[model samples]
Target: MSEQVPQLQQDPQQILEHVFGYSAFRGPQQAVIDTLVSGRDALVLMPTGGGKSLCYQIPALARPGCGVVISPLIALMQDQVEALQAAGVRAAFLNSSLPFNEVQDIETALLHGELDLLYLAPERLLQPRTLELLTRIELSLFAIDEAHCVSQWGHDFRADYLHLNCLHEQFPRVPRIALTATADQRTRGEIAQRLDLEQAEHFVSSFDRPNIQYRIAQKNNPRRQLLQFLRDEQQDNAGIVYCLSRAKVENTAEWLCQQGFNALPYHAGLPAQMRAEHQRRFLREDGVIVVATIAFGMGIDKPDVRFVAHLDLPKSVEAYYQETGRAGRDGEASTALLLYGLEDVVKLGQMAAMSEGSEEHKRQERNRLNAMLGLCEITSCRRQALLRYFAEEQLEPCGNCDTCLEPPQTWDGTQAATKLLSCVYRTGQRFGASHVIDVLRGSENEKVLKFNHHQVSTYGIGRELSANEWKGVVRQLVVRGYLEVEGEFQGLRLTEACRPLLRGEESIELRKLPPKARGERGESRRDSVAADIDPADEPLWQALRGCRKQLADDNGVPPYVIFHDATLRGMVQAKPQTPDQLLAVSGVGDSKLERFGEAFLTVLRESQAAPVEE
Candidate 1:
């Protein structure tokens, strides 16, 4: 006996304030909403925490029918639905996790117009039965989340996303909005083409995440370095540590646990149930860390993640940006720390070269890897380079990254470059960096002596620099396109770009090897969100957090689903004592004010009543 929900046809601004408790629209959200409400299509490229959801959610509630959303991840859909439901909006999701009866109930509700928003995965929405059902109900719009998946060049591509253009073909009149947090110019074009969004208006927001401090250091005992970072700065805060392999994920998680930190492992190889449970714990609990590969972070909705660390190099700038973008999602000051070495570059290069794909695909991948390496090696601002890669211009240097805080010294390396190139050529260019370094350093190792490289003209010519210094030169050369990694064993080969440097026609300036580890040096620059709180207000903050945890547990939702950390911080700072006062908080809507307003007010009142120790 379900009843059809009435569509209010309310103004978008009213919907934003009354339902979601936001005062106004952020960036291009209002324009995107207007486009959809006017029955037009939009392609939006906003950052992860840039209020992308409001672009469609407000329009859906204002329009006359349920908004059908195509999402890529089951967990993401569940989180969004829960958050919307908390705001008193009728929302539901269809995924394999639901039982048969629940699915039937949700489908029945959809038919009766009991839901304002409906979320479905691409595979399910493409089914004939689902398509048939959609035709029977009025759909306000079609929202495609993570729309970059439609591009084969995208980092998180899904084959099913390629068929999503059918939405345009099947429902020509339904206004559609495709949204993504990470997409290069090339990927954006592909997304528009594959999703049939060529005619859609494009909204590209600034890609900068200023609250995150970008720091990439040379790998010097990476495990110990990670431990130092956590213990020194983010000891009790929730964060994610990304590793490059499944074994590394498991090992890092287990090691963190042994070191007395709450940690979990997540990867495709883990059992589905375990992965789900781990993800659940990460979202619902506090101070929990998940060490995982790239498989784990596509659709995570947690907002208070304090930091994201990379123990190995990412393959491309897009992957690095998307992965690190997971942190400080609440717009708090957070850290993005990366530890890399010459070996990481070689390993990633080998992977790109050996991967199965078209030659063009392989070349693009190599170019992407080079870009990523350049990002790590650059002497200027990291944020500027990152934004530039996405075709966004940043004229001024960002004072937040490692280089800006402590600029690296540079030296004339023309002589060093010539010596290294000659060594590679003398040794036949068939050996890897290590053997080549040994030959240059006159090691007389078994391999070097056996190859008769000890008698070469360039033998021991690079003795002016240490082995590590020589590695820096080689790494920079490879990143600069003067050297290329090739063959099954990843031997270094000289490209035509190296001829000028070797022939003395061109001189090069290279970054001097840091006398100390960059990680230890950059420790003082790390900013934690907790630092924002006044020392005297610590007790009140704890009480508020405890209240949030209890309410979240009782309601069986993540703490953030009830109220984000920013909202809680607002409550603490304002100490609202009445319903009207509580409603002034940014995230407090009419629905939330009615449901949890009094409980929070009571907490605020009790805090006021406590006497000062002084």
Candidate 2:
């Protein structure tokens, strides 16, 4: 049975402005907080950087007792606790990183109600000793972060999530909240069943990130292409380059460093300490590129990531969305550029086939892979394609994506498909796309002559199209299910879906690639991120950040925990002269006003910028 505690209610807005310093809640955060403080369960589906934490954190502070957050990652727990503490909330954590004595002290504090929010890993919460300790105290609520990890079909799954359902069985009256950044309909149902949140209020925020510009390009000299993209789009801004393998991550990092870019490598195979140091540097320093595998980023709290480039294909649309969502978290203009070719598709398929999972799970994984391919080959707005996958409908094309900016022209592809498919069949489907393309373009080299004297009628017949153009046709056909790259050889073979095309009964219209290279400036949307301060006050803004960074370094925490960019902008605009003047600015809570108020005010007085508006 759960221990009963006295009910205490506080105005959430008062807490929000006075403690956390937000002017108002974004989207459904207020409603979610209201429902939770009223002792009702809720399930929140918000995009990354969408203030999901505030929904639970505010309620935890407003209602009686303490909030118990079941977090999956140790780093995530630490980051969240540090941020809350900076916001003047009573937050702490009990994880393996702490000593036994420290754990005991936290447990004592929990029992005595000395804490407002206590974060514990799911594994720790399920332990017998921890369960006994919890039974001796009162809990405000049970909040689960990253709820999608409970889904067996999710990209990142943890077996221990299955045991989380016991929270309800143990404390039937305690309300629970499950929160996630990404989940499809099936995964949502799985989360509800696994965490006993079926009856909870469902709050699904918009999946669109308008600040992120979407771009997909064909692979042609990928190294050169990546360098061009970084220079043209990001211009030395901090970003991430995602690769599929550890060796490639290392090589890419080394290459980027040799080219004078501050770059580092991160993967599961690296030494744990080394990986930690690299991640720390990436977080602490400015304009450092971290070339990493998918293992590196899950709930990274950095808000200034300018771009996310993919040298290889992601396994599914969910994976792509979650990874790309990490960029431009500050609502600034960012870019998600993916460069893929035939090998990415073939290798990803082979890996999914060889993975150790149940047959049904594998089938589902293949379906997800196909969906990702569909997004890559979409002819309309890329944002629409992404949003539609999550059951969201956008009636009009978004003017932000590459398609809406530069629509791909359609061409009659029936003859090109006939030429490419015949080359594959004549070559015995024993080789991959590169070789098949070579034969199609009538490469009468020794290998072509050795393979069969180039006797096929399709040979030399495709000279009208460039090699790049023909490769495009082959890729589109493979994506459309008319051809499959199979066997250990990774050769192209015809599926039943290809019979009509081969029999000349089906006409094909394939999208033509953009003639020129696309970059951030080519988009139709205006530069949407405006400077929050006046041009005359830009130097003061830099000085304020310098002070914040100095204090953050002294305190051994991320700079954002001291004050977010938005808060600093507010300070610059307001030019507060005293503690009382600062309190009126948004994000200037009592605790922050006391800690950072004097240093910031000193900077403002030295600059002597304009007076506050209104």
Predicted structure with the largest TM-score when compared to the true one: 1
lDDT winner = 1
Candidate 1 contains a number of clashing pairs equal to: 0
lDDT of 2 at 479: 94
Worst 10 residues of 1 by lDDT: 1-10
- For model 2, residues 1-614, the per-residue Cα lDDT tens digits are 12333365678899999988877889999999888887889999999989888899888888888889998887788888888888778899999889999988988888898999999999999999998988888778889998998999998798888899898999877778999989999999999988888888999999999888898888887898898777665655778999999999999999999888899999999998898888888777778899999997786888888889999999999999999998988877788989998889988999889999988978998999999999999888999999999999999998988888878789999988988887788778777877787777789788888877378776788888888887889899999998998898888887788778889999999989666455454532212233446777777888998999998898788888888777788888888888888888877898988887898888988888547546
Give the least accurate 10-residue stretch of model 2, judged by summed lDDT.
Answer: 523-532
Which digits, one per residue and each the tens of the lDDT, describe model 1 over residues 1-614? 01123344899999999899999899999899988888889999999899999999999999988999999999899999999999999999999999999999999999998999999999999999999999999889999999988888767989999999998999988889999999998999999988889999999999999989999887767888898888877877888999989999999999999999999999999999999999999999999999999998887899999889999999999999999999988998889999998788888877877888889999999889889988999999999999999999999999999899889899999998998898888888878888899988989778988989899998888887888888888888988988877887879889999998888899999998776443455444233554677878888888888888998999999999889988888998898988999999999999988887887888899999999887
lDDT of each: 0.89, 0.86
TM-score of 2: 0.95
